[model samples]
Target: MSEFSISDIGLKVGLEIHQQLATNKKLFCNCKPIESEEYSIKFQRKLRAVKSELGEYDPAVLFEKLKSKTIVYYANSESSCLVEQDEEPPHNLDNDAKDLALVIATSLHSKIFNEIYPMRKTVIDGSNTTGFQRTMLISQGGQIEVDGEKVGIQSICLEEDAAKLLGDKGNIREYSLDRLGVPLLEIALDPVEGDSKKIKKIALSLGRLLRSTKKVTRGIGSIRQDVNVSVKDGGGVVEVKGVQQLDQLEKVVEFEAKRQFGLVKIAEKLRNSDFEGISKRENIFDITENWKSCKSKIIQKALKDNSIIKAIKIENFSGMFGYTPFEGIRLGKEIGQLVKFYGIGGVFHSDELPNYGIEEDDILIVRNILKVNQNDAFLIIAAPSSKIDFAINSIINRLEEAKKGVPAETRLATQTGETVFLRPRPGASRMYPETDIPPISITNQELENATKNIPKSWDESLLELQKKYELNSQLSEQIFDSRYIELFEKIVGKIKVNPTFVASILCSTITNLERNGLNSKLLTEENIVKSFQLLAEGKIAKESIEIIYESIMSGKSQTIDEALRNASIETIDEVKVEEIIVDVIEKNQEIVKNQKERSIGPLMGIVMKELRGKVSGEIVNNLLLKNIKKKLGNI
Candidate 1:
């Protein structure tokens, strides 16, 4: 635990959720909003930062411009067009997407704008080919309640999703245009001060509300969350981008709170010790010669590759890099994060020295060369000569910010819930009026139509689901929240299966498989519906559904027939099932003789063990009872 609670630190969090809308066409193009696996078109472009209407360039765009990276794009005609390539102007606003946004806005009680103007938000990360993203503010000012506490909605905007980043080389990044220009609905929430659990609950409430509308797309990559976290009297607001999982939201918040608090403590300690910040001229030294004869494999490899080793000294900064005011919080990790952007693996600091293959002898040599002192700390990096000065200058700049609390920046969320520096946070200078598309005016009839699409309240929806499906509250809520809710309804409507069973398998069983490290996403909607269809036709038993799902998700099989063959599961006839039941009874005659009808329960296990995926348990049970009674009469 930390020295202070969440309230003690004055933690504030704001959430911005971006949900993909299920529309038939792209937001500004006629192409379908679909991702294609195959690409037939390819092109490359270099984007540059430009002044906004106010004659100001976004700091983030300028930062990316400094890298001078080339962006290569892959496109498929089925999902992209000239608009995505920036060769043609955008078409009129997508009406279906606009209506969906209006429905969400009306449902949230937000005031919709009479005329929506499109604006270009500068983005030079290669995710956008035009060097900017087109967005429109459709409505503003609404509120949602979480646990009896109200959190305000800032604004609702409909925009185009960016292209998917495929890979990144040092000077080049590859992207796919398949996802570009897709309709996206963004919901921004006002900042709220609370603990991690409350923050997570607030996010969940917002997600559930969108899902209740049933107009948003489902599955991974269909939705993303950008979390803005700041601590009072601590660092500036930091944005963690692309958090796709709800379970990871709380962890991201908790980790960020600790990180900002730790930075504040480090800043205070530096001020208390009367330490001056790092100066590049007097503090940096080239110590490549010191590691030429080292035994460490990393050093030897770097040396062999002609990489230079540079070190930076901080006065009165001893123990600050390793200081942990909170668990897993350290300034060294911050430095490590900055170095990664420059393609450096990591940095070796005095605090973690005498480890990582750098023996005590090597540390002593470095300390002596940098002028041995108890109150000083040093960081060394091994990189190509091209990156040495840039990496060192960044380190000094970051240390300068350390004198203040946390530096304002945008960080990427990792799988482990920790955040890493991506780029400096952008400011309002990024937005300018888009001239390609005209403003859209909302009419009374359109508003009325949108109102009709507003979904029921979450609680009411869950209650209605429970009543309509004759399901328990837990099962109903599970299906209602899961990605398969729509699919569950389709399956139940098309197949002659119990609604509760369909809900359970779609929600609980698939979740269990995912928890076991299986990718349930591999099971397509057609696959599930087809499997249930087979069950309804008595070609496959309910017992075989999980087996088929597991097989398909585990990559052992791709089709229903293949999954059945791989699992050795075939639908045995009722005659065959009765024969197996008779065999089991003959093997356990003494138990049947003693237990009579009670023997059915004990024999169920034996029968299922043989008929597990081959036949239905209901059929097995009925046949076992009938045969056991007939045998009892003979006895």
Candidate 2:
């Protein structure tokens, strides 16, 4: 990583940020913009690639159509309607959502268009039931500064978010319509040349600017980032999609830069070496007979199921597949990624042979069949007979592209921060004017109102929070960054508690709970408020809040009362608290006489051990000090 430099490679990185708006209704309908688990409507459909008005099909859509998947859509009445199901025409655009977009545009200092026309972007990936996403260009040409360097913003779009993909089984994919039609603001930044750290900083700076508006949704899936990375000498631009976490952004960029660089180097090696390009008849060989009595379970099952086992031979590519100029950068992994798109688990290349139960004898047999060359490499794929042609063609095409540098395509980011093949990059022909909704005219009065709604910057907001609550710098920043800032304020304003404590519980305690394998999301807003209310009313000690929340999250209790019972926290009166303290002091009489004031610490611990959640620690402390002092006078 230290060896590579962004400027040296002429790397260009662009960002497309999609954030869900915190609006009351869906972008095109009156349906509430929320997700629901109970779906009343379920249907399935098969979508195909359609040419735009220009009569050119999007390469991405064509790729999806080739795979041929059945899309199963699930819809709930509360969060979706006929508009989402594509059964009825869309209603008028929601004014609140439009206005919210305007506010963000104003904050970015962008040039807003007077008339906004929605466009249909073709998407046949089952994420959109209508086979397209509705997007409108609201503004264009603005810039944000990160670390004293200016990064230009290209365009800002107000769009309808796609459906949430549930999962996939075989050739069928499931999608939930509960998230469909929600309003999202897409901000595209101009491509910039920088290293991974600078790229991450730019992303963070833009994200903070968006969040400063406070009109966007929070929590997981509320915001998404799509990164387009390309090198000057290293092939084409590769767009990495759905980078949900900022911490993963740097690693994603680093790995992608190295991957593309390595790919370019491999192409150079092929050009200089005695490499004859891949041939269909010569490279694509049917090696099914060689694996008839194989020890490998995968091969045995494929043979039993009558699946075709095809292998491709690449001349003078023995060490090339396993070549890694950089750590974790290899062409074999790249080939495996492309094959998985066709529903094949993976491929076994000659570089990694004599493994996966493919004994040395089996390797020799494949080499003999493919006309053995010491420097040549071969890869085998086992799949259904119908998919053999498509799988082989796809592999041949990828290897061909390997002769060139990287192929321009969209890739999916994995949890490990590496990216894999998703689809080809869409062209300009993928978008056309949307006709369901009319063009909306933006008035000066609306722009003025939106400008007024633009909130303070992140630094100013954090400073205001500190001043208002008298909170320390760290706690204020934590609460501001946490998903519970609004709840923190509500808890403090509604209950008689220290604001700092509230911030800590929301930021630190909940995080600690999640780290300990507890789902703190189970503690709803209502439950959290109720617990604090109980604390203010002296029904439970301040120390008991965490215990009750833990109980609820751990599934030991459902309600506050039940949690209290589970933790055995009974609200003891002052009499009981003093009695417990006196009993503890009498038991530790020697310590009281010897340590005197120091006895206060040891005695308070013993007393609280018995009455932890029942009585306040403050009350126990006062009682222990007075009783200990009186006993010392008597002694």
Candidate 3:
């Protein structure tokens, strides 16, 4: 990647943060939000569009309908009910969730709305069984300061989270209802001006403010952010969804800004050209007979299945067809969405040809079949006759969008920080009243009570952490933002362990363990508290705290003694140390016989290995030198 200054690529970012509330039950059902039960039932369904109250359908919803997206829902009786499956009307909203939303709203200094109206936001992607998500605005127009700059808070909405989609194949998508209907508090931030650093600071500030309430769920997927980014040079808005990490958000924004900048440049270069109104030819033809020797598995499979191959003529896009703004995504991804939406396999272009066993003769043959000139790009899609027309239409639509610069679309985020087009951008008008749940009213008394009970602010938390735990400002800030801050305070205040040690492990050591693949989720606050209590009671070595934590994170449910034994970190016995030291001396008799001034390297390595993670390295070094000197007759 080339080095580009922040100013070189105009970066304007807005954040839509969704945090799941730690409610006792699902947003609309009696089932508990935190489910630990195995799924007992599974079923499949397809999403279809219904007209809005204005007697018009949302184009985005209709686009999904054309894709024939099907949904497969997995249910567990203990955690889900008919309400989640859309078979029954929802019960009353979860009050615990509503209360937490108010707590967060008050903490952010947002104005609470007197009447909360529940609305149904259209979602036809099968992530929701009801074809729409239940959402309601609670507060609006708050602001948070980042380095003396005010980052506007647009609104905060309380909504029910959608199901976790496991996977999709053909027209069917698998969903885990285990996470469905959890209450979520969504906070939208107004677009801020600055580089990635400032954007990150703003995001971190908001996240810490939310965590300060100590009322939100903490873990992977418990919180998500959607960023709507655009460049100053002019391009359509692109929404990136499900960004889980704050650091990754900066990278996503930077990358997206550059992507849009490049796209706008492309659009400008071609603006005056005659290719503006070029359209995709809709004529369909079978090219399987000519592609029998094709090496492309996708094409070969279609040929073997006797599927129809449809081609369209794209004008003045010969070399441009292979142009890519991001890795693994070409102009082809835009085209692929069309094919995916239309239930087709994929589309083939003329740019990277002569490779799929498609030779020059095949290219010429396709061009002749489509009756296009050399400067034109031809797209071919393979599918049954049932979907060939839709596929052809989708490809044409995508081509038209490509000509118009970056299309306004929603992209799904990957763990690697890349995004691909999920669907067209949803319109603002897709939201309507959710008739299933009655509108909730926020009483002034309730808001006042919540305000009174607001937790300590971030700066106050830092100061208190410093005063109570003897932590510096930097470490104190880290602990305040850590998920383990509450646990650290509980343990250190209850047990006699060193506060600094506890804080370090909670804020740093455990983070390292998680990066090494330990399941930190299993190591709860209670576990940490109990482990430290044992250490303070002289039941386990102080140095062995991390070892016990590692064991617990490795899926073992053992008492302190069992954990210590399993880790092989037994107390360093005098007899064992003497035996190991004598062995080291006997093996290195050559160095000892010389009786010259000795270097501690060889013996230090042997003793350290034997006592690793068991005793202090300093104690082992001292014992090794004492034993070595005794053997050398220097007493």
Evaluated with lDDT, which candidate comes out highest? 1
Q: List TM-score per model, in order.
A: 0.94, 0.93, 0.88
Ranking by TM-score: 1, 2, 3
Candidate 1 on 187-226: residue-level lDDT in tens? Answer: 9999999998998888889888888888888888788899
Better of 1 and 2 by TM-score: 1
* Comparing 2 and 3 on TM-score, the stronger one: 2
List candidate 1 stretches off by more than 4 Å. 1-3, 53-55, 589-602, 626-635
Selected candidate, larger lDDT, 2 vs 3:
2
> Weakest 10 consecutive residues, lDDT, candidate 1?
269-278
- What alpha-carbon RMSD in Å does predicted model 2 have with respect to the real structure? 2.5
Which lDDT tens digits does candidate 3 get at residues 1-635?
23345686666788899988877688888897655546788988878898888888887897788767668888888778999898999999888888888888887789899999999999988889989999999999888887788888899999888898788788678888888899999999998767777777888888888887777877678888998888775557889998988778877777777666666655665565556444443545667676676666777788788797766666676666676544444566557655665667567787777666566777777878778776677777788877787667666666666556777888877676666667788886688997766778888788888888888878876787799878888888877777677677778777888888888888888998988999887776667787777667655556677888888888775555667778887766667776777787778877766753363676677666666656656666677777767776752
Q: lDDT value for candidate 2?
A: 0.87
Distance (Å) between predicted and true CA of 41, model 2? 1.1
